[model samples]
Target: MRDLVAPALASLVCLAILIGLGVWQLERKAWKEALIDRIVARSRIDPPAPLPAFDAFDPARDEFERVRVHGRFLNDKETLVHGLAPGDTPGRALQGYYVITPLRLDDGRIVLVNRGFVPTELKEVARRAAGQVEGEATVTGMLRQSEVRAMFVPAPNPQTGEWFNRDVPGIAAAKGLATAGPSGVAPYLIEADQTPNPGGWPKGGQLRVDLPNNHLQYAFTWFGLALCLVGVFTAFALRRLRGETGNGETGENPASATATPPRP
Candidate 1:
């Protein structure tokens, strides 16, 4: 009984934890599915609509929405972020950098636009100067929310003008738009369309919406582990019970057996 106590308690605790993890994964699966659906539906909208007023911008409600804006590219203040370009072969990716340039809207507000991927050799502004459009331009693309940096993401180096994540606020602050009043800057970014640029160094339409849905697999793994633990605990308990029953039936008294042997 004493030996069984510790094992039983530990098994129960482990089982509960596994079940909790399984449930959590299931919930995450549902959320991911819904998010994918929303993104797909929004991406399919044809003839992109003009973006809403800057004052009405909502990251959560407007993310992934197809929008067009008339603005002038502030190419000098562009920030290049480390990125990868899709390769011709499946599952292959090419090293590159994304050109994030701020667009000065006609309404006197600024919005960051990810013009797209440029090869490592074309990373320098001078190398891709031909693609940089001067004067007024119309940008048609998808509106995206600011990306939160993950724990593993490295911090951006302001002096070097290199960034790891698409942190909109951080970029705006680093680019001297932080103090730009309420009507000064938009809180989101626009991923430019596939329209060809002049020099064609920085290719557009590089947005990849491939979100891996592995929650189902995770749920199955957790549930499977719980089932195996239950089987092991049941087997251990049954074997202990059988041993106790056999001992009682044989009337095996350890104290008497030893005392009699000592007297003889």
Candidate 2:
């Protein structure tokens, strides 16, 4: 009994921690599922709603809500976000840049639109001269929040026109974009839909709503390890307790002393 005390207590503590981690993963799974559903639902709305006032939009609640805005493209002010072409592209996937062009609204405010992916070969604006839209245009797409910079992501250099993430404010400031109305540039970005451009370059419709959800698999792994831990500890305790009991019995009934071992 004494020999099992330390291991028993330690096993109990380990069990608690393992179970806690499993529960946390389950919670994360539920959250990710809900978010994916929301994105799908919002993006499918017919005739996207008109853009609301800058102050009226809520980043926490309005992400992925499809909206339409009328504006003119500032084509020369394009910023290229380094990324890979979508797997659904016409041919083999190629390394490319997402042409993030600014749309100046009638109200004089600027909204950055992720026009879509363009291959490295057509990187120069001159190469794809036909796609550079002119005059007033209407863009219908999903609203998205800005991406956060991770530790490993390289910061954008002033000289380079490339970026790693969809950082709204950072791009706006660098491109010298602002608004005629209050709040300056819009807080969020508009991920344009797959509407064809005149010259068929800088293809539209590049929003990725679905994200990877593997929390369930991770939860199973943790729980399985915890079960193995219990089985091992149980076998150890049983063997140890049985050995101690047998030693005691043999010591009391030694062959030389018979039953007079403890009478003194």
Candidate 3:
């Protein structure tokens, strides 16, 4: 009887801990759902006013916030990022690159803008020669923080104009933009608002807003597993109690059936 006390208590404590974990996952699911809702609401609201000159970009603050910016295209410093796809039909599954060009903001800050996607063949000397943006231009695009690819990938060497990832600071320096100020270029990429462009490569304005909410399914799976474990333990405990009573009734023990000493 004493030995059973130790083992039974230990088993029950372990089950309680597992049930607690399942509850925690449900709480986490609710938190994630609320965050997604906030993002969706913000996306539909009107874009904020253009940021003033010398405003430092906060990667955490302005990540998904939309804002309009007017700038001139510095196409001469453009770099093509390899291994990007377009979402349009004419721009099918063919191999293409993101045309990353620097937009000199009205306040003198240089921002790397993903102008659009272009097929690799379009970058040939002859085709690219005819695709230049002539003179001063007004580019209406979102103010996006730089996108830094954290995983293992080839780095961008802007001198060769051969890039596999979007490294904004490196690209900014390669493009010969001054970065010694407080508002130095951010280390991210911006998807320009769907604006008209010449020489069609990067099909812009295809930014799809999607956030998956499968926490309900995940919560159900965890709770169901916990319930199954609880049912198993309850049956085992009841059967053990019944076995002790049956043994005493058959004269297998000196103790009476109703007052039998608990089995170990």
Candidate 4:
């Protein structure tokens, strides 16, 4: 019994850990589901609030927020990135590049506005220069976070007017603006709502808010595995215990029979 103590204790500890992991997965599932629900609710709200001032805007709370803004396109500072979708990503198709321009706000700050997708044929630097829409425009769109992925190249040459991805800091520096300081450019990007522009480039209004939360399934899998392991170990332990009992009974029976002697 004493020898079995250590092994049994170890087995119990392992079982507890497996159970704890299963519980943690369940909690994670719940959290993910709630997050999805919140996003869906925000996306479908009847009317969104007006765009906040640059001085008061906060990306973490305001990203994807639909609002109205008054600004003029700083077309000269536009940067074109390769492998972008021009609006409507119905099927995973790579059709064009994202022609992103900065909107000069009332304050000295700037907002990088993703004017929308333009086909590869229209991505030429000359074509872009010809497509500038100057003057003040009232645009209604969702505030967005910048999409910064791993760089295909070490550093982008903004001067070349070619970009691998939309890098706010690099693009800002290239635009002859100080890349630092509290009153500098906004951190995130903007996706304008389907507001039309003079140029034939795709209009904004391409908002897709899809979230996936399958924590329940994950929790079930983890718990199921833990139960299976416990069941297998229990069966093996019972089989060993039964075998020992049977051997002991047989040994006692023979001794008792001999003690009864040949007296039939």
Candidate 5:
């Protein structure tokens, strides 16, 4: 029994770690489900609402809220964000730039609007000339929070002014909207809806809600691995305990060592 202590302790420690991982994944599953539900519910909202006060905006409450705004597009100041979207034909994907154009609101305050995707070839404004809507316009879209740059995702390229994430503050500063009067620019962005553009180049309605809910599967995997670990440890402990007994797995009696094999 004394000899089994160290191995038993190690086995128990490993078992605890496996179980901890399983529990953590289960927690993640619940969190992911709640997040997905909130976003989906927002998408189904019937009528778009008015924009909130600049200072009143909160990421928690404001995100995914469908909003309507009366504005004029600052076409010349369009910033490109790298994106991929499904093309006219299914399955084949198109690499493009999501045209982040500033919309000067009726009251003079500005907000960044993701007009939609335009392929690399249409990058030159001249190529997709007609899509740029002139004069005042009414736009409806879902409010989106500025994307936080992840650890592994590369930062925007200063040389070419290329931005990958929907970083509202940085884009606003770059476009000189950071101090566009006292109101300046809204911190959040508006992902435009599928209302067609003039030339249909910068396609609208590109909001994608793809939150992968693999946490439940991950929890199952972790729990399954923990069970396997328990089974293996149980077998090891049984073998170790058997070895400690006088009649071990081989069933060779310890007394035979001294009895000299019956003088065969």
Candidate 6:
């Protein structure tokens, strides 16, 4: 009984930790499912709603919501962010850049628009000058939040005009639109629709809403690990009990027998 105390206590602590981790994964699974369902329903809405006022924008509540806005593109201020073409091509991934331009709204305010992908060769604005719209034009697309960079993602290099994420504030600041007073740029960006552009350089409708839902698998894996821990603990306890029983049946105390050794 004394020998089992420390091992049993350690096993119980390990089992509790495993179970806790499993439960946390299950919670994450539920959150991911709800997020998927919400986005799916939002994406299916026909004829996107009008773009909400800048003051009313909410990333969590309005992300993926289809909306339309009438604005003029600031072609000169367009920024290119690194990206890969969507779809599984047999060869290497088609490395490209997403053209993010500022759209000046009718109210004099500005908002960033992800005009979409352009091949690496056509990354220059002059290379696709025809696609640059002049004057006021109505743009329809999905509203997206400012991208949050992962820990592994390198920071944007403003000096070299290179960007890795759709950082609205950073881009606006770089373009000198951060302090545009009442016409300050919005916090979010608009992912342009599939409308064809002149010169066909900055292609639109590149929103990738198909988020992977592997949380359930992860949850199962955690739960399975917890079960394994329980099984191992049970086996160890059983073996210990069996050994003690055998020593008692043979009329030999394990500790006394070991300590006494062979008689001279």
Tens-place lDDT per residue, model 5, 1-264, is: 686688778878887887888899899989988988898787667788888777678878878988889989999889998889898899988998999999999988998899999999998999998999999988988999889998977799745879998888888887767652348888788999998999997998888878888877887887888889788878767776666443544655767686546665
RMSD of each: 4.3, 4.5, 6.6, 4.9, 3.2, 4.6
Candidate 6 runs further than 4 Å off:
87-91, 178-182, 244-264
Model 4 TM-score relative to the real fold: 0.75
Ranking by lDDT: 1, 5, 2, 6, 4, 3
lDDT of 3 by residue, 86-198 (tens): 53576566577777887776676666778766787786536766556666665554445555666787766666888886667777887787673546654555666677666
lDDT of 6 at 98: 94
lDDT of 1 by residue, 1-264 (tens): 787999999999999999999999999999999998888777767877777666677766777888888989998889989988888999999898999999998878888999999988898787778988999999988998778888998988988887999988888999888543468777788999898988986788988677899999999999999999999999878878666553446335667655335565
Q: Where does candidate 6 clash, by residue pair?
A: none
Best by lDDT: 1
The local distance difference test score of model 1 is 0.86
TM-score of 5: 0.87
TM-score result, candidate 1: 0.82
Cα displacement (angstroms), candidate 1, residue 35, comes to: 1.3
- Residue 225 error for model 3, in Å? 2.0
What is the per-residue lDDT of model 6 for residues 57-90, given as tens digits with 9 covering 90 to 100?
7778898998888878888898999998764667
lDDT, candidate 2, 36-90, per-residue tens = 8987888887878777567677776788889999989998889999878656657
Residue pairs clashing, model 3? 116-202, 117-201, 117-202, 118-201, 118-202, 146-187, 146-188, 146-189, 147-188, 147-189
* Predictions in order: lDDT: 0.86, 0.84, 0.65, 0.69, 0.84, 0.83
* Candidate 1: regions farther than 4 A off: 1-6, 53-56, 178-181, 244-264
Worst 10 residues of 3 by lDDT: 244-253
Check candidate 2 and list the clashing pairs.
108-180, 193-205, 194-205
Which candidate order results from sorting by TM-score in descending order?
5, 2, 6, 1, 4, 3
